[model samples]
Target: MNLELGKILFTAAIADAVSNSKDFSAFVCQSIEKHKTCNWGDCDPEDSHQNDLSFESGGRILSVYKNPAAHEDSEPKIWIITEWDRSITTVLYPSDY
Candidate 1:
């Protein structure tokens, strides 16, 4: 699957961690791959308003959802978020709507 980084708002410490850890990057990639096969209901069953999908890999949690900025009638753009532990969550854009 194709993946792209969005408006990344990482803290300095998290930035350092990302730069220093190849494993984290790999986990993020794996998460994206997992996101490809995930159905909307995979993340939460009752939360039907948002079609966010999530999966776990290498002790990290990753999610993919529709980009809020995209128009309702336009082609969908997917946003990816990888949570490395509890403190760091990286957001990405897989495609532009």
Candidate 2:
């Protein structure tokens, strides 16, 4: 799949994880490879929609959703949102969402 990292808005806790550890990053990539959509059942109902899915990577959860605006002629752009274990969530985009 054509995956890319866009604007990564991280929460305070997630920011620390990104800067201090590589597990979170690895999990994101793995989740994309293993599951393309949010069929894992723990997804946030509010964010999930057609072509948009959520996943649980290790102890963290992430939302891998489609970016409607980033869609090309035939290809669609996907964005990753890093959701921390806490109540903190991060929004990211490869381009403007």
Candidate 3:
């Protein structure tokens, strides 16, 4: 059965990426714009040269439910995700995960 993530805003936001920083936010935004789905492998690169950021870092999280009706498409959303330990947590705007 398909599960609904409840009342969570599944929006995309671009986080600040510094030089040599693992830019998971960038990946999330790119993935959402490209696939409309969030997966760890979405940003994974098989080659070291192509490698930059991995979704495993928990930096970029998928919003739980679809965007709220009042929320405009141009607005970014926040989401709750099940972490490695099977716990629900909120990702802060400036958080790495």
- Pick by TM-score: which candidate is best? 1
Angstrom error at residue 29, model 3: 23
What TM-scores do the predictions have? 0.33, 0.31, 0.23
Q: Model 1: residues >4 Å from true position, as ranges?
A: 1-15, 39-42, 47-97
Which of 2 and 3 is the better model by lDDT?
A: 2
RMSD of each: 13.5, 14.0, 12.6
Which segments of model 3 are wrong by more than 4 Å?
1-65, 71-76, 91-97
The lDDT of model 3 is 0.32
Ranking of models by TM-score: 1, 2, 3
Query: Which is the leading candidate under lDDT?
Result: 1
Backbone steric clashes in candidate 2, count:
5
lDDT of 1 by residue, 3-71 (tens): 232334544443453476675445445544555444331344543223232233223444555433344
lDDT of 3 by residue, 27-78 (tens): 3444334322333222223421122121334333333222232225322333
Question: Model 1 — TM-score against the truth?
Answer: 0.33
Please identify model 2 stretches exceeding 4 Å from their true place.
1-6, 29-41, 44-47, 50-97
Candidate 3 clashing pairs, residues 3+ apart or interchain = 10-63
